[model samples]
Target: MTSFLDEFAQAPNLKYLNHAAVSPWPKRAALAASRFAEQNVLLGARDYPEWMGVEQRLRERLMRLLNAPSTDDIALVKNTSEALSFVAFGLDWQAGDQVIISDEEFPSNRVVWEALQPRGVEVIQVNLKGMDPESALLAACGPRTRLLSISSVQYVSGLRLDIERLGEGLRQRDVLFCVDAIQQLGALPFDAIAAQCDFAMADGHKWLLGPEGLGVFYCRAELREQLKLQEYGWHMLEHMGDYSRIEWQPARSARRFECGSPNMLGTMALEASLSLLEEVGMATVGKLIEERVLWLQEGLERLPGIQLHSPMNPARRAGIITFSLEGHDNQVVFDRLKAEQVVCVQRGGGIRLSPHFYTAPKVIEETLAVLHGLAG
Candidate 1:
């Protein structure tokens, strides 16, 4: 039997630990994209309908990955930021309406809400430093609070939130819950229905191991039309292929959010990447990544002058682990690691390392060995 790790044949000496930012495509995904390009070059639009089948499959796969109620709930968007914009600008915000977010949000989650300030909507940044983060977020939701948009896993600190609890609480309070699931979708088992989220979005490039320009946006069935549509085109029309029709409305399905032609090239890669995930099984994938994170955490804990920034509890984290050296600046440590071909990032006041399920144990060992040399 062929080892699954062979699908990710990276440079022998390169220790890649930055899946949270962008992931290299699996061999299958790369081949899929290449084949797509070849088809485009040779036959052009002759096989376009077949390509649409791939796009449909991509939507179906995303629906399965998100545990969504139906494929009707999934919209193929350009990225997480664009999906967030759909929700931000779509809502009918009153002057006194309040939107609550966390202090540690990536600018995608924070800036969208902040942009609403011109509409007289107040954006509240809640501190998640307390023992009970869910409770703290819930407490911030008052009479005028309209919605709570949060990341399933904090991008910087690698703090995974109790999403089910927060979602249920917001549901009871009649508050809209939106999840920025870019970091969690492929790294952990995610369920939009179980979380009771009104909206959810994730980019395919991160943990999905797809290209950067394509992503999935999930809207609850009931709230689909409640969000005002900002863009329009033939694809988003109710009668999509009926070019001669004089009158038209947006699609009743989640397709309404997709204003223009789909990223067929990106679709080819993402569909192939997701097929790989389905084959591995998300449960198995999550377990492997957790093992890697625990291994990294244990190694870092034993090293001198290493200060952990991410949550220690296994239940409170996903694939990310971050730490800082006691005597070295974060940039200095990050540059040193980069110089050695340890592909990582400087984030959340420290050096952030994110390993996917396919990451080799040798990579983790080599990273620890490098840190050991730095300590000495």
Candidate 2:
């Protein structure tokens, strides 16, 4: 097993704090991708059986990472948005049916729900700013509430919702619980089975440290045939390789969501990347990321002009800490951080800094120092 530091061959000049967007691939993932490319160059589909094995491993890894009921519950989708769309459009919705969501959701989560408005489905946006956001969301769920679609950790604010409570609460109501877990999955321990959620989706590009085009969508085993298939192709059939078979139906598992050819290259990278996280263990990963985020939070709190947008409590946050200088434009702060090689982004009226578990302490310290110096 390679040491975590040995795995990250990132340059010293690059203080990467942008995992919320795309992530820097670790050495193992890069090597996996290179090996895949080499196989394509030399042997091509002659070794296609081996590729299926890799894809199966990716599914198993995602299943374990999500604490899903089985590997069959996982589907390798292109991204979170695609998976979200499958749910947004597939559900048997009636006119006036409501879907609950937070106001702070990323556009992917927001737009998909809003698109359903033409069908007479109403999108309910609840503010998560107050002390009792979960209660507020639950309260908003009335007779017509069909689903409560929410992000596990808010993108810009790093607000980690109590998914278990929300799931349990919605379970008794006739409302389905769907979690967009891109920001929380790899950064923390997320259990789909434990939460009793109907559906969950997450991209691998964030804390998972994989390529951008790959993600996992976990729909409960019993609910597989429930989501009506929008896209269809040969790949999703149960007898996919048996072209001679006359009987055809979408797969009984969550693989039915995969409508076409697989993203083999992305699967190779994500599988290898997950190898590193499994070795570190999710609990350790969560603890390490929490420390880094808290370090940033505390430093920003001490700064004269900086104001925090993320929660002050560690339990309420996953792996993001956002802040802004009192007098500067968001773009200006973003530009300064970029110029300094302290990679960050401007979001939710502030600068969002997301550091992974492997991020060194010095990088966080230096980034904060540079930010304070610039503000001063």
Q: lDDT of each prediction vs. the true structure?
A: 0.95, 0.91
TM-score of 2: 0.98
In the range 227-284, model 1's lDDT, one tens digit per residue, is 9999989999989989999999999999999988999999999999999999999999
Expressed as tens digits, the lDDT of each residue in 300-338 for candidate 2 is 888888789999988899999889889888898888888
| Top lDDT prediction, candidate number | 1
Task: Give each model's clash number.
Answer: 0, 0
Among these predictions, the greatest TM-score belongs to 1
Candidate 1: global Cα-lDDT?
Answer: 0.95
Native-to-model Cα distance after best TM-score fit, residue 265 in candidate 2, in Å? 0.6
